[model samples]
Target: MIGMGSSRTQRPHTDRRDWDNLKSVLPFLLDFRSRAIFALSCLVLSKVATVGVPVMLKGIVDALEHKPEQVVVLPIALLLGYGLLRLLSAAFNELRDVVFARVRYRAMRRLSLRVLEHLHTQSLRFHLERKIGAISRDLERGTRSVSSLMNFMTFSIIPIMVEFLLVGIILLKEYPPIFALITFGTIAVYVWFTLRMADWRMDDRHTMNTLDSQANNQAIDSLVNYETVKYFNNEHLELARYDKTLNEWEGYAVKSQTSMSLLNFGQSAIIAVGVTIIMWVAANDVLQGQMSLGSLVMVNAFMLQLFIPLNSLGMIYRSLKYTLADMDTVFRLLDQQPEIQDLPHAPALKVAKGEIRFEQVEFGYQADRQILHGLTLTIPAGKTVAVVGQSGAGKSTLARLLYRFYDVTGGAIFIDGQDIRAVTQESLRRAIGIVPQDTVLFNETLRFNLQYGKPDATQADLEQAARMAHIAEFIAKLPDGWDTVVGERGLKLSGGEKQRVAIARAILKQPPILIFDEATSSLDSTTERAIQRTLEEVAGDHTTLIIAHRLSTIVNADQIVVLDAGRVVEQGTHPALLALKGHYAALWELQQREEQH
Candidate 1:
């Protein structure tokens, strides 16, 4: 596909700018800054109480050591203090979780909404080229990563760092310099190993994500084309395709798990060796009358405090990295710029007479391959004009340009002499209603699909429109009536039923400018004639553009224009075109012969 405008520099996560990706989350979190600050404060208080537990236990030990007789008499104050510290630690941790819950979940909610709205703002080209399943997975994983990141930072990493600071201070103040050296040195080594392993494991994570998205995309695509698959009996072929991606994902997942096991074991060994060295030194100090048993107990308790959180550091670091990668994918989507943008402060389009004119328009989906070439046409105010042509004659392209799905490459289109480019897209679209050839309806209730054209339309308005489209009788006969659910893409309904629903929806909108691009092509001969009559009646006073393939259906149009090779070859009234015996006449004779048979 040819890029219509300047290409965007934004792409999916490719580099290791983890810090920049992390910064993208600040906007969502800033909304709850007060709550976030309270949560952090609670986290610090919890760690303070947790560290105090070891100190209180050391005090209780020393008090009992002062007298063996005191063994029978508990150190009541110290024991109570120890219990209170433990209680405070648990309470504050819970309080932190409670306070931060809104911040984390709200970030996820707001981010999801922003991504969705951004996708909507993108041009039709972007959606056409997107892989639904892969985008779906990205959206799911990205939103979830926000919660994971916040939870790990607020509850795990921050608290662990606080505890480490307290332990380092106590060790340096109360013990020999060698003790603090062993403790700090061991931490440095553990952190280094964990970060190194996490970086190595990141490759496996990225591979798994790619393979996983590919498999999901294939599965969804196959299911979406379920009828085609069944017709070709390609069940096994699809299975093999899905299995191939899954097999690769499985291999990497196993590798990731095995490597994680190794990292964990390495961490355990480092912690074990460090604790043994510290204990041996403390034991020697006590034996040499340089340290008391209480001092030894305090050192042991401090190691336990640090050891517990350090043990899980490897997994937390790996998960944090993975979450950052997920978040980057979403941020990349947010950065995508839409190809079609209205002028700054563009005004809404006013439809005074609804006269549309295509003034020497030129357009193409690709740069080298043009679809419409200098095509000029006009539909007078409150009149109907029909365009007829062979396939690929740019019949449908006219409707797309008029809808401003893509901007014209050369000349401009105008409504009531006002350039379309000068108007806001939403207002321009609102003034026009189109029933496309392929009428894909939402998988929703029949009433919902109709009301989509005018969300606040009343019941009488719906019934009147449905009746005009000749679909009301059919809907009334159904067991569920208007409440019937249209399956995905309206697959549950026949093609004719879907077309009728499309017509009803457009009629419900009742716009001044109406477009029926092959609108009746799906209906049977009887239904087609009936709906065609109704369409003629509905377009009696509206400025209507009818793009048709069947020549008979557009015989009564005020003017019929025949297109060939992206140019208007002939245009006149039905009798006048037949008299000219040109492209329109030849097409009429061809369709006439086909209809007779």
Candidate 2:
């Protein structure tokens, strides 16, 4: 709870700069520029025919008025012709929708993939500092908004603009100055009001979205710790807290909806008034012999057609505002440069003999607080080395350094005489396999989980690795065997089962070097003994480094390194370190006392 900052406490404020951010998403659309332009062109043609249909009906009416007897075939023919044109327009419209949908889906797929790739390249610290739920929510909302934005822009906004322009042109040809002035003036007023309402609602939508993310984060957190909540009988308290956040979210949502409703009502009223005034003027012109009744009918039809697109204009603007808000977070995430990035001309790591040497390495999570200070160590190939230390003694940090999770602040780490800093991260990571204390597994089948380390691993190889980890027998006893779903984060499996799965995955990877960060810390004594035997068998085949807290666990290690307060105080063979009466000896004595008790 120390770093917990309530998102609800951060009040949302709209910046006019959101429009600029929204414009930034346009480049993604521009990637398929040719297709987008073609789609828009087709949409325009369809809209023109759509607007023209009403005018054609006016022509039919006028033709009926003039002939009244001899034009039956011609009227029927014209009606059929108009119907065919409308059908063609509808087809074109459908085609445009299909093309744009493909374009939007492709763009979203590429963007999401890019974001994921970027995240994968980022350092462990970057992920540790952020909440998983928040990141997930941002990505999900951003993708959905971008897709909806593409639809709104093509199918709604652009088509509406074209319809408005066409209506103005038609009116200008018929009544010149009078029609142009009325049409342009109405549009200007409508746009002004739409922008105003959109500006007001933008902040509310942002607030609502922030609350949504918080609610999701809280829900995920509670669900993950459901057992703890039940054990403590705090389910009611958790529900109340969730309900409070939901109520806050509802408040902002209601405000946004109410504002939108008012905007819609105001827009409708303006459109009604504008159409009434235009009709009244046209009616006067017809009576005064300045315009024919047919012309007046055409103008009325065009007016009705214009309002169809105009009504959607407000909704489009509102959606555009929300899209901008969504992009703000997406761009913010995309713009973040990783704290640790590869060197421009980094080389691949040469094949290593599992010899690791850390020379005067200094490191810290923050600038003001250092963790490891001038620490130096070496582990030779094909040896089982144990790092024994109390918590926060930088034992885990040292293991992370071995994997290049964070570069040393000063000095260097070398693997097989090659500086880790000069080596490509991919190659370096591929050479090392780590089994973390808290094993994380995907919600997938056991086979998939086992093959995660080596995607192309054969079934025989998988079974062999599982057997070595002592998990094959347990897996066979399961209802679905290797095909059983592990559930989220391997929650379906016991801690010992999950640890064995992690070990099995690492074993299948067959890296030159292996790291075990208290791998058996979560297991019972019986399971630990089984895993210890497996570790001994694996040690003969690979260079293994382990962080051990239980003294008995490391008694057979080739070398035992004792650390205290981020510095190595004693290191030798287990028997030698125990005989030295140093820090290792003292810790061993304490552990033995606890075991006896």
Candidate 3:
């Protein structure tokens, strides 16, 4: 079995936690390396153009201060270059975004696919424990956060640093070292303060995310149970729950904004102080004829340009932190190892006789409670075996084990004298067909759901299967016929209708082994009897396991197995067991009395 465990990510991104996420994203970047490189090149070019803007303005100011008679055509050229520089900055940024679009979309697509694939492989317990609304909300947020984090780091954070470096170098060459020291020190302090404050705000952000997900989950849960809410008159209770979550979220929202206020005020104070010191030095230089007024204008312009990005420093950092938290959830889902997997070099299951045997099968979903205890049973080839049991007697569990949904905890299950664990799960499952008690159909047309069993079934095959399942007469009466839509979970159809659809689906599969897991439980006596007849025809010479509650449904079974607790107490033909007057006979008598009453 190959289990790809949790990876923090491939390469390190913003921090250590981002390593796993970025590692997963590295391949997408490498796949489009040329475009990434071109985009990066544009980033540098754009920053260069941006840094030159202040210099050109300085030149224009110097020329304006000089006599018009003494000025030459140089100032006019400088003005045009200044305009051109602004245009190039905007143009290069837009072009870079255009070039990198493919990389962004491809990365999101691959990661989303990987997440989805892994979620499908997870055990049923994992899905049962989590709400669908919350799970979907986290995944959606995580995928979107990937794009945001990348955009912020590349465009906002990285480009701003590059511009600051260029401005610092220019200021140093043009003035005394004290001016550069003041600007750099102020920036360093501003960054440190913003990071510390943003780190604290992360708790509030996390709380907000939790409350937001709860609110969404509650709202969706209530909506999905719309009929139940209306029947119980619980609309006020649902609204009260939803209102509570929002109110808590609102409290955190206020705290988040308040903290942001403090950060902004502190950052602005630092920048104002630095700019004032620089202006003071520049005015002294101008008075002493050591610096021109235009030089002072250029220095102030650099400060203004640099302050723009710093203003959002806390917000950007906080957003990136939250994004990584969301992505961590996705990565955690991707990292989960499926409990059951096909062994290495496992071959496809080859069914020569389709005989199924459970040898001392002991199993449970949890270790503390056992569902099946030393259960031994077998269905011979070309025969029907009925497993009759009361509620929680391991009837459904036997069906699940036969399907290999969960491996036996203490023993092995075999099909055709071959251990199921030794064969590929895909092939093992492919060789068996099951029509579960609850039939969940896609929200699609009848034709689509029918053909889902055999994707390439011919029109004649579809009609034949539908007729055999006793659903053809009903479909033909509908105006849309096969094209008629089945609502979500097939809720639009009656219970009997859904069961027939499931039976038709199984019939089309043409597997060597069939499991009818309370397949007719949802139908009325008349419809159930009709479906049972169709099932008998489909069973043919293949192995069949019928897990039924009503003894009447399995009276004709070749062999009947009576289960109590976790063990099979009796096994034989229904008549043979009745003659023996054992547990099977007693149960049969009880059912007869109930029916008479």
The C-alpha TM-scores of every prediction are: 0.96, 0.95, 0.93
Candidate 2 lDDT, tens digit per residue, 107-223?
A: 789879878988888889998877777789999988777787888888888888788777777777767697878877988898899898888777778888888887787787788
Highest lDDT: give the candidate number: 1
Q: Tell me the tens digit of each residue's lDDT in model 1 across 1-597.
A: 112243322223448567887888888789999999999998999999999988888878888887667765567878888999999999999999999999998998898999999998888889888888888999999999989999899988988999999988988888889999999899999999999988878878887887787778889988998998899998998887777778888988999999999999999999999999999999999999898888899889989988888898778888899998888888888888998899999999999999999999999999999999999999999999999999999999999889988999999999999899999999999999999999988999999999999999999999999999999999999999999999999999999999999999999999999999999988899999999899999999799999999888899999998999899999999999999998888888998899889
User: Global lDDT for candidate 1?
Assistant: 0.90
Worst 10 residues of 1 by lDDT: 1-10
Look at candidate 1 and give me any clashing residue pairs.
none
Sort every candidate by lDDT, greatest first: 1, 3, 2
lDDT of each: 0.90, 0.84, 0.85
Off by over 4 Å in 3: 1-16, 70-72
lDDT score, residue 89, model 1? Answer: 93
**Residue range 261-364, candidate 3, lDDT tens digits:** 88888878887887788789888998999889889889888888987777776677778788887787677667778877889999999999999999999999
Number of colliding residue pairs in each model: 0, 0, 5
lDDT of 3 at 378: 87
